[model samples]
Structure formats: structure tokens, C-alpha cells
Target: MSEKPVVRSSILPIPKSIGLVWLNIALALILAAIGLGVGFAQSGLAAQQVILYTVLMAATVFVLLNYVAVVFEARAEARAVASEEDQEAESSRLRQLWADNRVLAIAMATLLVLYLILTAAIPEFRSIKNLIGFLVLELILLFAFKISGYFAAGRSAFIGLIVLFALIVISAFSIEGFLSGPNIKAILLFAAFLGIASVGQTMVALLGGLDLSIPFVIGSSNIALLFLITLGVPSYVAFGFILVLGGIVGFLNGVMSYRLQGQALIVTLGTGFAVAGFTQIMTSIGSQFAGNVFGTVPGWLSNLAAMNGRFFGIPFPPTIFIWLAIAVILIVGLKTTTWGRNLYALGGNRRSARLIGISEFKYWVGCYVISGVFAALAGSLLLGWSGGAFIGVGDPYLFTTLAAVVIGGTSLLGGNGGYGFTVIGVLVLQVLTSFLLGIGLEYEWQQFIFGLLILPMVALYGRSPHIRATV
Candidate 1:
């Protein structure tokens, strides 16, 4: 009889990468040098010295762990000689493990490299707080990813929330006053604006279209609201008029883009430019600047979005609750309503949806109309927050709206994401911006970092087939 075949355990041996080990060592050495330099530059108080030495020790322990893991992996590989079939099977399993973990590994390496580079190159980054914050943040992310492996169904979504939690922790720990009442209120207030602004972009993306005109709509509506108010229109009345105008703009965008098929981006962008120019021209007829539209913001409107504004005697702003309400409504509406189902059907497969008697035209137009109304609402609310308006006021929304929607895991291809995800995305962006600002990063670096962060999400989602293809 043939000798019995040897069997391996279910868990695959950890794969080894010598390059990663070397990277860990290099980073450790750099970190040690930084620690020494800081010590020599200023031997501070007892507590400060303790923190510095603790950080160095943590780095040493981390490097030692990596080396120990690599050594174990090496020994395992050396002792694992077997038949050709077993060897091939083990190789396949190792490859699978590598594929599954390569992204996390690369992310960790990239972050560590950035940590070292930024700390060395940027004067602002050389602080002990920043060094500890970086380490803590990296560990949080690693823990989150490791825990995410247990719940495979919604791992990506869960990872986002975990990351948000991690950021909150890191920010609270590292920033002097990040969790202070004023700062918290500020973050929530701005998040409310972005969340509201993102509403239209989210809806449009769900329908497989983009409204580049959102920023323009935002700017124009912001100006228009103030202009109307200055013309003696009651604030509420002006608000209503502006919303209607936004809806009309949305209607035109939907109609024209629908007719043009693949030119939604171009059409909406052109429409936005035209609307912005027209609004600027109209508002500037008797004014000095295209962007300046000054008017007294109403008390009610101010209470709606101001950071100091309260909700039923609570310290929080009303805008936060309003956003929460809107998010809940949209989330439920998208998941349960007939219109929502039709919207998904239309987006997931237009041809099939038509066969099922769904009107693509109606849904498409309706989505843009909703988008326009939200953009207008955001602008109006922002007026209260800012107490004035400018033509470029809505400019930042151009990138952020899209980024929030995409970062929330909404497929740009449509029919796969919801307002719930967008809410998380909004929070993430707000917190991240606050964190960056706290750390003294410049605007350009923040934008650069944002772009880099978005690429990974795009690549991750792109790997999956679209909803239509899956169907």
C-alpha cells in the first residue's frame, strides 16, 4: 500500500517578503534617529521625555515583531518540503493569501513611508504628538482591517465606519481641542452643509449620471437667494423661489443630458457655467463684484445652520438634526419606495427597465430635479451659516460632493449605493478635514492627500462587476 499522504492544517503558513522586513527596519531606524534628534534638541519635562522614549520603544517592539514573524515564516517554509502535488497545492494557497492581503500590506507600507517622509521633510510634522498620533492611527487601521475579516458580507462598509471611529479617536487624542464643544459644533455644522450638498450628487450618481452643475447651482442659488432678499422679497419667499429655480435648472439638465446620452458630464458642466455666469451678471448689474451678494440673514435661517445654533435647548446645531432627518428619509425612500425601486431598475438596466414599464425619462429627470433642489437648499442653508454669498462659494462642493458619494461606496455606475453610505462619507470627509487642519497641513497638501485616498476606493470598487453585469 502507498504511504499515507501528509495533511496540512486549514490555516496557511504566513507568506514571507524580505523586502517588507527591510522596510520595517529602515523605518524603525529613521524613527529612532528622529527620537534622538528631538531629545538632543530639547530635553523637556519628565512627562515629555517619557512620551518620547515610549514612542521609541513602541517602534522597537514593532520592528522586532516583524522580524520574529519573518523568521517563523522562513522556518516553516524550510520544513514544508513535500510531494510535487502538495507543493503545488501549498503554493496556490500561499498565492491566494498574498492576493487577499497585498492591499493591506501595501497600504501599511505606504502610510509608514509617508509618516517618515513627512516627519523628516515638514517642520510641522516633527512634533511628538504627531509622531504618536501616526503610530496610533496606523495601529487602529490595522486592527480594523483584521477585525473586518470576520464579517465578509459588508466588510468594505464596516471598514469605513471603523476608520471613521479610528480617526475620531486619533484626532481627539492628538489635537489640543478637537473634541471641544466649539470644535465639535463646527465640525457638525460644516458636515451638515456638505451632507446636504451631497444629497443631489448622491441621487444623480445612483442614476448613473453626474451633475457637474451642482457647484454652479450652489453658487448661483447662494447669490440668487441673497439678491432676492435684498430686493425686498421675504427670506422665506426668496428661499422658495430659489429652490424652484434650482428644480428648473435640474429639469433642463436632465432633459438635455438625457437626449445627449453619454454627454451628461459635459452638458451639466456647460449648464453650470452658463447659470453661474448669468447669475453673476444679473447680480453684478448694480454691484462691484460677481461673487459678493450681501444681505442680512434671517434669524430663523441663522438658527438652522449656525454653529452656535441650538436644537430645542440642546447645545447642538439644528442643521445636524435636519441632515440626520433628511438622511433617514432618503435612505428609507431609496430602499422601499416604488420610485426608488424604479430608479434602481432604470439605472441598473435601462433596456430591461423599459421592458418592465419603467419610464427612464421620468426617473432620470426626477433625480436631477431632486439634486437641484438639494443643491439649492444647501446654498440657502449656507447663506445662514456664512451670512453672505459669493459666486465661488459652491466651488469646493464640486470635488467634495463627488468624493463623498464615491467614498461612501456608491458605485459611480449606479444602483449599488445609498444615502446611508453617503452619510458616512460625509462624516469621514468632515473629520478628515478637521484632522488635517488641526495638524497644520496646508490646503494643497489636503487636496493632494484626498486625491490619493480616493484612488484606492475607486480601484477596489472597480474590481467588482456593475449591478447590471451581475444581474
Candidate 2:
């Protein structure tokens, strides 16, 4: 053994930029293939599609070769790390290289594995049509990962806009009639409702609180408003009463949660349940259904939210304008008002706020009260749209309101977001929902995808230093 010393040989390093070039080429081919496939799947492929797909075939060969190259490179890196004299330094370099090129590395590895599995196990997966569809989705995932960096550093809302725009582009190209006037109007109509419902949630979140009662209040108020109208009460009067009822609920939520030391989530959820139960009991008195109310909504009220309803002779619904107005007012008010300033201060740091003469009770209670009123308003407006009221009508808002708030880039930790962010969030969610539906995904899939989407957003914000740390 002493006659010959063994020499360890390290594999050659592969430049990370090579992986990027491969990825870009793959994406270009995939996009062309997707546009051709989706655009011609119904009708026979046009000459244009034929030519494009032919080009795609050639590109696919190029991509496959690149994938092989990536595999060899990865193997080289692994062997180099194992054979290096200074294992620690080599490992550090390997990690740094991965950190610098993770998107490409992950994309290459994942696509290669999936391609191998699909081609081997499922022959149909090799079909041009299926392959194009698969690649389209892969493009979207890669794009999402590439842009996720924008979610960090408090750039959530801005990045949200980018995502929304991308969604619109992709949907318009992929789904027939996606950008048509009717679909556009439908999206706005739905967005208006969610936006109004989200107002309170946005406000409450700005102060570091959650209101689970919004959906419950919305349901109860929808029932109450229709029931009151049926019982011959004036519509305006009934609407005002519902708003007052919501205010009362919010007041209780704020007072109790504040006293309980910021247990807003539980307190509001409990309050919502109680309100829903009480409303059902009351509405059941002369109706066959516990939470159903049938009545004619006033024409003016119907115009507020109905898609066919117009604003100033314009085809657009008044509800959109209403939401726009509310957004503008809240955006300005939150910036210019003493109340807004104090709320932010209180939400940011209660102890410091107290020292500055800001009363946490007053601001906290006020925000919750505002949330309640908006929720009730949303419910009543919904009556105008639906033509009948059901207690479960607002049930969807429970998730949507909070989702809109979070997606809008509002911080749950308080003192960081505004209604402005909520508006973008509402639009993004509405558009996303529509896109998902248009593509024929079921509701369950939509929910699943939404859950997946929120995780990374939460992680992005969670990476920030805690509020306590800042203090």
C-alpha cells in the first residue's frame, strides 16, 4: 500500500448560466406549444399550429439534450463535493451555487424526473397535446417561483399586481372569451361584493385583529333585511337597522376581545356564531326555513349590486362605483385622519401608543365597529343582487374576506397594511377564481390551490423580523 498513493479526482464544475439558458429555451418552446394546443384543441390544428408545433418538436429535442447535460452537471457537482480535499469549503461552495441557481436547478431536476416517469409509465403522456398542456402548467409554476422573491420585503401588494396581470394574460390567451366584455363585467361585479365585505377585515387587520364574524353578520343581515322588507318595514329603515346591528356585534367583539388581551380571532368567531344562531331562531318564526327570507328588493337597492344595473346611465353597476368610492375614501382617510394615525400607533405598539395618549380601546373598538357596518352593508347589497336572502349567502365571505385581506398584502401582525392593498387583493382573488372556473377546475381544486398559494405568501411575510423584535 505504501508503494502507491491513491489520488482522488474531482468532477469538472458546470456553469450555472448553462442551466438558465436551457430553462429559457424550454419556456419559449412550451409557450408556443401551449398557445397552439389550447387555441386549436377544439378545431383541427391550423397550418400555423402545425408549423409552430413542428418547431416545438425540434426545440423539445434540444431541451431533452439540455436536460441530459444538467444531469451530468449535477452528478459532477456531487462527485466533486465527495472527492474534495477540503470537504467543508467544497460543501459551502456547493450550497452557494445552489442558492444562486436554485430556480434553474429545481426546474431542471423536477422536469427531468417528471418527464422520465410520465414517458415511462404513461404512454399517452407523450402525446403532443398532453405534453403541451403539461408544459403550460410547468411554465406557470416556474414563473411563480421566479417571482416569489417579490413577496418578501413588504412588496406583496406590488407583486400581487404582477401576479394578477400575469393571470389575466394567461387566461386571456388560454381560455376562449376570457377577455370578453361580459366576463370582464362579471369579474368586476363579484369583486365589488368581496371588496366591500373586505373593508372591515382590512381595517381590523391594520390594527392587528381578525373578524371572523363578517360572514356570519353578512348572512344574518341578509336574512334580516329581506325579512324586514317582507314584514312591511321601509327598505331604508331596515337597511339602517341591519347596519346598526352589525355595529353592535362589532362593539361587543372589540370590547370583549380587548379585555381578553387580543383574542380577536376567537372572540369574533364566537360572536359570529352567536349572531348566526340568534338570527336563525328569529327568522324561523314564520318561515318554513330557518335562514331563508323571500321578498322584493327595492329597485334602487337592486341597482346597487346587480350586473344589469347601471350607474348614471352607464352599463356598469353602482356597486363597483360604491366600492371604488369607499376605497378612495378609506385610502385617503387612513392617511390624513387623526383616527387613522392613532389606530396605526395602537396597532404597532400598544404600550408606546398609550404613552402618546392614544387609547387602544377607542381605536380598537372603532375599527371593529367599522368592520361590522361594512359587513352588514355588504349583506344588504347582496340582497339586491340575489333577489332573495339565505343565511349561508355570506358564508363564502368568511374565507374570501380574509383571503382578500391577506392577498392584498396586509400584515396580520398589525400596523402595516391599508384598504389600498385590499382592493388589489380583491381583484386578484376574483380574477383567480374566475380563471380557475373557466379552466374547468372544481371548487375543491380551487380551494386546494388557494391554500397552496397562501403558504408561500405567509412564509414570505413570516421571514420578516417580528413586531416585538422591532420594538
Candidate 3:
């Protein structure tokens, strides 16, 4: 057999040209040394002793690292032949990674086109503000790309943030109300909505599945609550029941898909259609609540979604805190909990998970149930924030939630991901959309641009259908 060549996996065409990642650390250290030197020179004996000890401790770290490098080098040389095999195997794995994520490259090229077009279109393109913004954005891109690899889950988030930051800087100088408090608050309120809804999508994506029923689930759940309140059910009781109803829908999805061994996407699609029909029925039943207008949602529900409220002198949507709370729970649970670990295991490799005694059925059921509950919760917020849902109330979220999930860096193929990263992605996307709208793009164009951006994350982060080659 001819010798096999190893293919390396890399999303970036030239990944290492990014920027000086350690620049901040180096500057901080230099500043610290100068400050300490100055202080130590003029300090009393006791203060001098403390400063000297701190410097010695920092110096020891460098010495220890050098010693470690020398020892590692000697050991590596001794294991040269074995190391070669490891490298070959690693290269093959990397090649597989690249194959799985090749779509990311297409996305990158597409975005570059978009950036160039936007640059020319921008009113301030030749202005100092534009030049300064692009310079800063380029530097950020360099640092982000340079450090990106197996360790980070928020590659797209970092990229999106840089792009948005550049826009903010440019717009602040040119646009009359660009960075004003109202505009910023408006952007954040929308982010609050998109980000909260994305939590469900992120959960489902982590299990390597998609939930198409979210729109209907959310719409129907909120409308159902209104319908129930009309029937004299207590508002709080209706809320709880609506939540459980959503979970029931998800459970059915899990059961039918698992038993039939059907594709999850198809199964969820079927459930979504069913829920959509149910929403229509609920709307018809609740039509009586509308005397002249459509419906009268509870005061408390409306209050939660109110954006004019001042919380501790900071004007923000009361519901924003709710998203923050959910984010904290998800981040902590996914990072530190046993169930969370098993979740990744199941998403990563179902067959291997089962071999280790992880109940595939139960975890799958749990993941969807969690998704359903959150979707229902989001529906209530949507109703309050948007002043109640109609046939298409959940329409916007279908794309926005998915976009946030993908951009947030949760793998669509399952396993590796978390909520904190997703939140950053949510803000990035919301900010991006806001900038596009500010630049006078129509709604369709705004959607089109974001829709375009979403493709890269899905293409790059997806991990499905493992492949191997031999010749």
C-alpha cells in the first residue's frame, strides 16, 4: 500500500495570523513591575519585603515554566517514534473535523462579501469614524481567530461581537441617536426576547435534535392561558397548566420518535403542525374574550414585559432579569451537574452512552421536556411583551431562536456547548440586526443578512455522519 497522507483540520485559511493574544497580559505585567519597582524603592522595610516577595513569586513562575519545557522536550525526543504515530492519528482526526465543518468556509467567504458590500454602502465609509471602527474590528478579529480551537465554544460569538462593536463605534459618531440610552435599551429588550427563546433551542440542539414545534407550542400555550382565564381558571393555575401542556407535547414527540426510530427533525415537524392546529382552535374558543379588541391578558403578565419600568433607577424590561436568571441556572447546571455531564455524553455518542448504562430513552425524553417547558415559559413572555399572539406570533422566533442557537456555538450535532456562550451569541446577533436596521435595510433585508450569517455557524459547528477513508 502507498503511504497515506494526513489531512489537517482548520476552519481558518491561515489560522495563526490573528493577533497578539498575550498582549494584554504582557502590558499588565510590565505595568505591574514598574509600579512595584517604584513603590518598593520608596517604601518602608515591611512594604518593601511584601513587594519583593510578590516579584519573587512572579519570577519563580517563569523559571518553573522554563524547566518544564526543557523536561518535556527531552521526554518528547525520547518518544519521537511513538509521537509520530500520535501526530498521524491526530492529523487524521483533524482532517475528519475539517470535512465535517467545510461549510464554515463557505460562510466565511459569504460574510466577507457582505462586509465589503456594506462597507461601500455605508454613508461613513470614508469618514474617520469608519476607518477607526474597521481598524478596531480587524484587531479583534485577529485575536479571536488566533485563539480559536478545540477549547472555545463561542467562535462565531466573538466574530459577531467584533462586527457589532465596529458598527457601534461607527454609528455613534455619525448617527444622531445611535448610542443613546433609548436605542441601546431597545436593542437589549429584543435581545432579551431572542435570548430567552434560544435557551430551548440550545437544549434541543445539545441533544443533536431540533424542535420545530416551538412556535406553535409557544403561541398555543399563551393563547391557551388566555382562554383558560376566560373560563374562570386562576391566572397562575392556567400558567402552570400551559407549561405542563407544552411538556406533554414534547413527551409525545420523544416517544413517537424513539419508538419509530424516526428522524427527530421530521417528528418535531409533525408535532409543530399539530400544535399549530391546536392554536387555531384555542383562538376560536377564546374569541369571546375580545369585546372590541382581541384579548385582555393579566395585569401581572403585562407588567413583567413592560419596558418602561425602572428597576433600581435603571430603566429596563423586567423580563430581562428572568432571562438572566434562566441563563445562570443553565450555565451552572451544564457546567457542574451529573445530569448535565450525561446529557453531553448522550448527545456525543448514544451508542457509547448506552454501553455505559445511560438510558437513551430517558435522557431523550428529559431533553425535550426541558425544551418544551422553556418554550411554554417564553410564550407567556411573548404574549406579555408583544401584547398577545395571533396565528403568527411565534413566527419571528422560529428563525431568531435558531440563529441565536447556532451563532451561540451550540453544536447542532450535539454534545459540546453551554448557555453563557449562547447568551453572548444572542447579544451579537441582536446587535447585528439592530445595526442593519439602523443602516436603513428593510425588514426582509435584515432577515436576509442574519439568515446569511446563521449558515456559517451551522455549517462549521455541525458534527454528524462520521467518515473515514482508505486507499
TM-score of each prediction: 0.86, 0.79, 0.69
Model 2 clashing residue pairs (backbone): none
lDDT of 1 at 177: 91
Worst 10 residues of 3 by lDDT: 12-21
Model 1 compared with the native: what TM-score? 0.86
Q: Rate the local accuracy (lDDT) of all candidates.
A: 0.81, 0.78, 0.67
Estimate candidate 2's alpha-carbon lDDT, on a 0 to 1 scale.
0.78
Residue-level lDDT tens digits of model 3 in 1-471:
223332233331221212322433354466456445544554344676757755775565444444444454444454464556766775698899877545655655766676666556654333334444544654554454444544354555555555556556756764568788888888877788777777778887877888887877777776777767767889889889988988998898878767767488888878988887866765575355421125678877777776675555667777788888888999999979989888888778878789999998998888788778877887877777766555566778777777777666666778756677688778877777777677677777677677775665455443334211110
TM-score winner among the candidates?
1
User: Model 3, stretches more than 4 Å misplaced?
Assistant: 1-109, 115-139, 149-174, 285-293, 310-314, 456-471
Q: Best candidate per lDDT, number?
A: 1
lDDT of 1 at 183: 92
- Report the lDDT tens digits of candidate 1 across residue range 49-96: 756785766576555657566666664564465567766766898899
